[model samples]
Target: MQKHIYILLTILSAGVLMGCEGYLDQKPRKSLVVPETLDDLQALLDNAVIMNSNVPGLGLLASDDVFMEEAGWAGLFAEMEQQTYLWRRDGGFEVIGEWNGAYQKVFYSNVVLERLHEMEEVVSANERGRWMALKGAALFFRGSAFYDLVRIFAQAYQPGVNDSEMGIPLKLTARVTERPGRATLEETYKQIIGDLNQAIEFLPVTASSLNRPNKPVAESLLADLHLQLGNYSMARDLSSSLLQAGTLLDFNELNPEDPFPVPFLNSEVLFQSVMAVYSFTFSSLVQVNPILQASYAANDLRGRIFLNRQNPQVVTFKGSYCGNFDYFAGISLNELYLINSEARIRTGDVAGGMEVLNTLLEKRFEAGTFQPLEASSVATALAFVLMERRKELLFRPSRWYDLRRLNNDSEYATTLVREMGGNTYILAPGDNRYVFPIPQVEVDQGMKQNP
Candidate 1:
């Protein structure tokens, strides 16, 4: 199976690299071996290097969770990385792996979907379940990629205001000849929600591997999407349903002295994915935001488990649910808990929300040191949930999405500031720079660029 995957990947890579006209216009070679069997399609998705990992990392770089000193900023090897860290908009990103990697997942998903459509009529009765699972996995991958892309490249979805806003191009087919233009933000999310809804119905209750999508994984992603869209009732309902069976790993079980306290694919993770590797991420000069580090209580196990303090001002993040140097980009029960807690509070179930928040926190802190968190009002409960969400999901792409969505709410809006070499940079709420510019290569091919 590994040998077969290698051959397929080689063929796919050749085809993708054969064109330079546009990011999405790479036509597969006519002589290439096409995936025809269920095993073949499954193997394609199972290529975890391409399908599971390689999620966008620019969001993590741009997020406020970590920062670099001037020396670290100057030491970054890639100008694009430095530019992204500082939120520059003066030039197109020369290296667009973040954009290309996401679209690569879309391309592979389309390959599976198109092939499945071809074989649907002739699928044997015994193969029906496998067929549905493949289709569901493909849809989930596509929807997941689209969601990541929009979160990075488009403006925040404003209910009535985003109908006319430009969004990432929606590539629904494998044919490279179809150079579809950018979809409206409304159309983009409609496609994502529709794809995920179908995925939930077709996927099995549990995936064969944590790297694959399942019913619960689709539901979780959809719930998160709705939460970002401000559909609190729907988000709360979906997250609540998942939590009925979800479990979190107690921090007490982990040794904070270990380089990575959370094991890879631990019990709490419903899916597994790592962010695209960036030199900036592992740079020695980068440090956790001092204020964020200080927010963790001394008795909170998460403080010791999630961060490595080199000194008073040089603390670094060590807790990646991926359980290694790679930053985790996967969905976990911890995230769903936070999502449910916030959604419940937003929807006026303040007491219920506090209970959910405290339940999760109890497992995060030292076994007996955690006290139940209380709030006098919905406003206070929301503040607590949002702050915990930030702490709990540090270094994950969640912070970028949170920043984008929360900026719309006046009460939670934030102005991010960075200081280096006697210079200060500020990103105000709703700044146009929040929308990343499309890759120039794609722009040269006639795709619209972000402002």
Candidate 2:
């Protein structure tokens, strides 16, 4: 069964590697089935091949939240993993599979959406709603993939260069022959917001499992995207609405001594997806950043859930929601809460934001000892929210995005530094290195590459 899925994915991904010019000019294959049935379209979305897994792990690799010992860094067997850990902008990093994996998911989504309209003639009226929901799911998947790809590959979104900056190519159609160039940052985000808004309109309020996206899932993505774009009002309003359905897990109920502090499919997780496992970097020798560990208050339970002490001085991460190994990169109720709190604080609702942050922190800190945080001013409140956001969402593939967005604001901009083998590497704010190079294959095939 898996072999068949691989073959299907190969067929879907064939054009992703080539320049869009003459892409669909290939001869038709006898084995590939054009999605004609409702089940066939749904199967594309349901296929775990492109949908459930293989979202990039690049964010974690480049993030300051996770680090490695000298031996671990030296022992990295995969060339891509090693370059990624060093924050190298070289194109060799695409060998890690995120470039191909994410684009392939986008390809699958396009196939599902393009075929949905054709199914109307053969499908029954009663099932049209189901088909529409599937269409929405495909949109959600495509938007999500584009979201990941744009953030990783393009320069940070800046209002000043909104129309000129290069964003990932917006591949809306499934035509393998379509020749598409990189869209501007403004246009790319416009498409993402449009797809997500439509997805929210069509998705069911509830999903049967965390594996599928629901209305809340679409809402969460939009909220997160808004926060990244510095649209605090929109982010705050959207995330606040989700609070009705969002639930925060109480850390007190968890056993700290357990091998995995956060169990699989925890109540807080709204969607389920794991990043590609880079054991040579994550589970094997990667150590939690000392500064991040120190940020946790003495009474905070997140320190326990996010990091486990191998010895007093050496700690390793064990908080992956996958139970072990792979890192959980999905949206969750707790993330929505943080986004709402940050948006409120940024938008001058300091007291309201503090109250929201306290609600989540209370569940994370020791029961009776948890005191509510007080912010004397909006600046203080925003700073507190940002700090807590880092602590709350560590190793979840968000800190990289946070760094990118925050770097645009002088008040919050940070300069990242790494010392390796007696040399210092610095990633300064607004540095071109913030934009990862386009993958070698894309460049080799005539795609415009990031500067």
Candidate 3:
């Protein structure tokens, strides 16, 4: 279903042709065309969010730029160490795939926004709601992509010093000739919030189905922004609000054959994209680091997700257990509730937060066993909450953000990342190499690239 949408996006974008820099080069050979109605925009948006999904045989061979040195399918010999993801950081594989995916999505947003006004007659109660939702989704995508660009390409979020911080190109109103400057971190974040609030107000809490964005998705992002800014209280309140109201998939009910080690597809997932597994060759590239492996206690159900694959030294969790069980679906209600739980702790509602965390753990843990956190140290509580976040969200593509947030502080900073041959590597905060560089082509065309 997701892959089908990308095919449509290619057709829509290709029909318009050459308006954007990378429009001509999108993969899978699609024909571009202009969107004439709301349905067209929504379809394009859907594909934008999912993109080239399923087909587990094509696993992500992208390297971690700073951690491991591996032979990538692109025939590049590279090693990644701490704070590195090749496609995201080095603009080769991981970084580039995500980058291309983001910009291509952004381009679709631009085309729709440009053409939306021409179809004023199409507006109605249902259509109006849909329009607002789609716009919000676009902003959400753009804001999210840019937000990452700032964190990964620039510096950490320091509220007052944003102007001085080297942020990503703030693609405010998508215009072909708009020579936009890199907006301050403060301004960029403000825009993200504004778009989200509006999105939440307009988008229905219920999505078209399980796999699309909706009101909770907007709120989930809002909570994420606050958390990154160190606005613990706000993060706590908003996250809690979203979680308590959402429905989550009970892991206990999971089919015995289905191997979703990380239960992210619960009612708690605000929105979901796809849950898929790839070829065995790709599976070898992914294994939980020893740090996480050792962290899981015997009582914790999460330990089951990580498997010892025939040897004590070689361990891969449930998500990575085998090619047959690798399912990949994005956020649902369960995650939001966890976010709320973390927020509760961050806001100093230690009891409230612990209650939520335990509620979740009780289900994941065996029938009756669960650990109750004391959260005595504000520091410990914060760390504990984040650890839970990591455990629950393992392999969901959100860890990079967590790592970026941690990189700004010692308590959360991780010296650990995927490691390979020889255990030596490099990441350049000096050049913002850990974050993403503006695609060199994008930089050439007047957009201010990150430092």
Candidate 4:
């Protein structure tokens, strides 16, 4: 069964790569089996290797949280990695894993959804629950893939002014021959939100595994999207409602000596997914940004647990929530807490915001040496929350999205600088380069490229 699914996925991927037409016209072989049963569709979605892992890592590479020394920069295995790190504007780079990987997820979701729709008419009373769950899962996966694509390939979504900007193409069906050009930013977001809303209604309160989507996962993702859109009140309410379901890990109980101190599928994780692996991510020469590493206090257990000090002068990140070398890029309770805190502060509940922030921080610091953080004004409270957010979520794929949305506000805007081999490259806030150019292969197929 797994072999058949792989063959189907291979065919779908080839169709996508071959100009989205004619490839589907090839005669079906005996080995190629179209998914028609609930079990068959479920198995496809259950293939975590294809569905949950290898999300885009370009955003992490482009973000300012990590840096490479001159030697490390020169030693990178791929020219694409160096180009992404430098934030190059040219379209000379070829198709990357990030783009192909995300669209593969989209293809998988579309396949499941199309099959589910066909099976819906004949679904028996006993199988209704499974049917709904499968549909909800499909929508969640597709919405997630779209969200990641837009954040990397399109401009930051401004609520009122920039809704007309070109967003990633919305591939809603299994048909590869249909070329649905780029949708507007507004349409893309609406589709994402709509899918999640319906998914929330259909999904059970819990899933069998962390890799699967459930009601809480969908709601949390929706809240995250709201936070990104600057809808503070909505984000505040959603995150607050889900707070009781979260459990934070105490850093004091962890062993800092372990190469990966955090355990896989730990209490804080609400979902499980990993970033696409890049050679530089695990290279010895790559080090955590000095400023970010310096922000942790002496008593803060996170600094000790999250960073591996190679020598007096060097530090590299070893605290992936994945509990190994794989960089975790999934939603977590820690992230929700930060989101709730920031939303409360932004919505004029500074005191409430600080309280939530303190709760999470208490678990992060050494038990006896920790003190509750406070703020007298919204500005001060927001600053505290934002700082903790950066510290807690470092090395995740979110920094790029955070940079894009935060750059819209003059007070929060940031200018990223990278120096390598005696040359300094700067990316100003709101720079056009922030929106990565669509893969040249996609461009050659008539897709519009970013300027």
Please report the candidate that would top TM-score against the real structure. 1
Separate clash counts for every candidate: 0, 2, 52, 0
Q: Looking at model 2, report the run of 10 residues with the lowest lDDT sum.
A: 1-10
lDDT of 4 at 41: 81
lDDT of 4: 0.84
Q: Over 4 Å off in model 4, which ranges?
A: 1-30
Candidate 2 clashing pairs, residues 3+ apart or interchain: 24-176, 24-177
> What's model 1's lDDT at 107?
84
> Which candidate gets the maximum lDDT versus the true structure?
1
Q: What C-alpha lDDT values do all the predictions have?
A: 0.86, 0.79, 0.55, 0.84
In what order do the candidates fall by TM-score, top score first? Answer: 1, 4, 2, 3
lDDT of each residue in 281-367, candidate 4, tens digit only: 788777888999999999999898889985747689999999998999888999999999999999999999999999999999998
Model 3 residue runs over 4 Å out of place are: 1-31, 48-94, 121-126, 254-266, 274-281, 306-311, 320-329, 417-420, 426-431, 446-451
When 2 and 4 are scored with TM-score, the better candidate is 4
**After superposing candidate 2, which stretches have Cα over 4 Å from the reference?**
1-29, 90-96
Would you give me the overall lDDT of model 1? Answer: 0.86
